[model samples]
Target: MPGKRRMAQSARAARCLGVRSRPGALALVACLMGVPEARAFDLFGLFGREEAPPAPRPDALPYAVRLQGVEDDDLLSALQDASTLYRLRGEPPPDGEGLLRRAEADATRLVDALWGYGYYSGTVAFRIEDVVLGGDAAARAAVRAAEATRNRRLVAVRISVEQGPLYRLRRIAVRDASGRPLDLPARLTRVGDDEPARSATVLAREARIIDQLRAQGHPFAKVVRREPVVDHADRAMDVAFTVDPGPKAALGAVAVRGTSSLDPAVVRSFIYAEPGDPYSPEAIAGIRRSVTRVEALGGVRVREGEALDPDGRLPVFVDITERAPNLLGVSARYSTVDGPGVRGYWANRNLFGGGESLRIDADLSYLGLGQDYYARRRKLAGIETNGLGGRLAATFVKPALFGTRNDLLAGAFIGREVQQSYLSDAAGGTVALRHRFSDTFSVQAGIEGQVGYARDVLGRVDYRLIGLPVSVSYDSTDNPLDPTRGIRLTASATPYPSFLGSDPGLFVAKAQGSTYYALDEDANTILAARLGFGSISGAGLAEIPASLRFFAGGGGSIRGYAYRTVGPIGPFQLPIGGRSLLEGSVEARIKITDTIGIVPFLDAGTAFASSLPDFDEPIRYAAGLGLRYYTGFGPIRVDLAVPLNPDKALKQPPVALYISIGQAF
Candidate 1:
């Protein structure tokens, strides 16, 4: 009867206050198993039902939760059971405002907790009901009723699944900036926590994987997670991604343009690319490097493009701008046989915009030397005979005449030579053409003639004879300092075929061979060897020039005798520039550091003629040491040599000193 009366009172109180309760919020206020009543008051599940709320415990109790201003017992019970406010079994009153505030705060906390679990739109609320005191000590009874509400139990609370399934990639499709398709790897990444695929949410991760593929050579790759079923009733997702692979392009050809000054042949030889070559950024860069190697040129631009023909082949292009030079320079050289030599020139490269290198030049030299003899009976010293001569040459050269690597250098000049011992004076000129076979090979061939006049030491007069000179050489060494790495072999021969009037077509046959070898890892050591043989037969021995003949034993030859002081086909004469001279040097060179080095050498040579001066005589030998310091242009060398035979010397055992640049060979 008491419970029935409490229920009736609760119904009357709910009607009077017009209070409504929500099942979810009431369930939250209600207390479930293992939850304390004092704390359950803050959770709506503490309330048993919508119509009946719990009551607070006694106000005098410790840690008691009380919904204040409640007079009806049944209504209090209803409200308390549905509220989140709860208190200990024995606690003082927790006021109504404080209880409501706690409830609100707990509701907000519940919403936040849901969000923390990926429930982005999750919510919470509190349900309320009015109550009235129903028995003796009705306020206490109402408080107890509220406590009962806070102690209500919750059964079967709903939990929504907020996370979905994972996605795994099936394939990738790629394309380039030109909209060309690109090949991609067949394997794709699986996404989202490594679980089974259940939803299309894996699409985002698939896109990421595709982007990575594109970055690694598959520029146009893409991924699309295709989920065939809408509901995923089978709990399994099969994804398909389409891939389109286009053709791979190779380099088909190379083209050069805008090269007005440089020879196309030269440019072609320097290029690294060839037809049907693979496209390489490095090779394209090499073309630019080739342009820079040209001596007199300007800016170079390189690009890759499709050929003009519809064949759709890619080719490399090089465009060049050529610079211009207007002035020229000249140089001269001299020796005892060629004295007071002088040469001058005028040049204009890039002339008339037709890209022509025109050079006009000339050269001249005079040579004279004599030894003085004394006659005691005459009581006077007189100048005897040695030799004297002069030579003059002129040339006109038009390099790149047809805008190519070939050159035609043609001109004519006159010359004269005087030798008192030979009693001869001669002059000649030449016209020639030189064509560069490649960047490294060039061939020059020409014809010349000379006439000679002479006064001999024996008072024998001879008429001048003319001859032709022809020669050919092959050179391919890149480093001038170490020609041994590459070799230059030359051969020349001339046989007298005419007399003084008609300018002899040939005479004086000669043939020479020179070779070099690079020895060290850095090409710092070199071994050079040469063999030469020639003959001149046109007049009496005294009327023919012997100075133009061969001689051995000099700073550069045998290294033990003064220059040109070695021979004259006799027992008293040192090995004269014989008809045959065989010379060879073996040198050990080392670059001690970047700037300096030492070379120890053994030089041996012999000059001989079949007619006299026993051709089988022992060869003269010299051992020497040299020091070299590298410079901006070349190396400076100083050498000191000592002949193995000491008594052969007039003063200091035949020691020779020399200073020069470049290799002896």
Candidate 2:
């Protein structure tokens, strides 16, 4: 009776509000009359009033993780890397159910990771909110209850690891495919008894065995089977490999492919292997290197035939991709003391259908307003007014000359150079035979002749000269422009006999070397150092041409000083050049970002008046900082240097600026 009376009253109220037939009118009237149950019902929702949307979940969920019970850093790191829950903690699952699935998957992955590191009996356990996963249903229910109350707050996840004693290899065996013991050298199989039974080491040993057989003229060598047995009681593992080494063979016919605009004869000439010779991997690699060295070829691939020829010999093929025949490029540089310079070059990689290259270069310098500022400031008495200095040169290279490692190199150059010390106009040519003993080492012997007019503080003179130049160089660095490891060394001597020159002749000898050290694995930090020495003998300083004398101050030598200003000075404070030179530099290259780096460097040494460096003479010192913007080709460098020990008499600048490409060394 009471329920009917209340319904009637609500209907009467809805009618009074002029909405008696509306579907939600009763609810609205109940809300206005302060009924608690009616207040909980949403009148607006019933009438199509849109409710506010739920907030978006974050891309990465908030969580806390802990790893426990592993003392070995390497093992711990490996385990973490293998666990999806640890690696992808930021990307949490959408719900509690998803998280449970992830936890279960991680257990299997972590155990496999441990086994790879020789921990065959390792175990992993995960706990969420103090409830162990994979436990009874009640435990899972507790975890879910906890998750439901988290309100998107941080959830605690813990991983407990128990790594048992490391398993060691008890026996290792290598056999033929027939299960008969093979007579392979023990060193070929790197695994040994009592060593940790790491899966990687076992796999690598199999590869090593196969490689040894192939290197010994077995082209069809392969590993037929690999078996490992683990004994948990003994905490040891036994491994065995069965190999199949097919019949030994020699090298047979060689063919060329993919040569378009390249002469087949030229490609054949670079092949160091001859038919009937024993098959060798090194020989194939050498042939590939030779073909790749030709600038006209962009890609070179050497492949062995899948099946031996009827003669029971391996066949080889050389595949090549040709590059454009002609190339043109331009480069620019600047320095406060040397002004700005620009260089341009054009090259023909394949001339006359052979691996011959011809290149022509032209360069111009002293294009800035401060070209002669240093000379004028020093009040040099006989220094010429600065003008555009330039050079024009052409070079040609004929590779693999006369079917040998020797290359024929020839070049001619004519140039006008205006320096603070002197001015000269000269033309010369050189012809040389360069022999490459290896990729990292080479030697050259050449004859050169020059005719030039030079003017310095001593006055103007015309001279003719001829000389024999010999040099040896070794470079093991990884990059020519920006090296991070290895060393580069060069030694050269050129002697001009008095009978071969209009003026008294001189002998010049020089040696220089640089080395790089990577301070970290990624080569983000590097330490580099360089040293150079030069000497002029067989003539007095005044008797030799100024261009032949040694001078040590410039962007290439001791930075932070004007060009040629670190050597002996003659009358009117003008550099007279020197008979000997010594210079050195050291720098620390540190990368702040992937494409940006900073270098702090120190440079020292100078030229002396004697035929060798005089320790008694004071050496100049400079220090600077540099900025580098790394690009695909190389680093673009900008340096600001200051002289540590300034010579007031020479009026050196407070700071010097240089902008160029490549490392200082």
Question: Candidate 1 residues 1-665, lDDT tens each?
Answer: 25554345324222211211222222223322224444434444434433332333434222233344434343344344433343222222344333334444444334322222222233343332233323345435444444554423311111122222222222223444455553544444333443433122234334555555534423334432222211123333333443332223455566668775555655554554566654445456656765555544567788766332245445567777776666677776654322456777776665544434556656554434432111121122121333333444455555554555555565554544432223235555566666655444566666655555443223323343344455666765655554546666666665555553542232465555666677766776666665555555543344444444556666667665445434444322222245545666767666787779787878776655532335556666778988878787777887888877432422223567777887555
Model 2: which ten-residue window has the lowest total lDDT? 16-25
lDDT of 2 by residue, 588-630 (tens): 9999999999999999988888999998888999999999999
**Which candidate leads the pack in TM-score?**
2
Task: Enumerate clash totals for all models, in the order shown.
Answer: 84, 0
Give each model's whole-structure lDDT. Answer: 0.47, 0.76
Q: What local lDDT score does residue 158 receive in model 1, on the 0 to 100 scale?
A: 17
* Local lDDT at 358 for model 2: 98
- The true-versus-predicted C-alpha distance at residue 451 of model 2, in Å, is 2.8
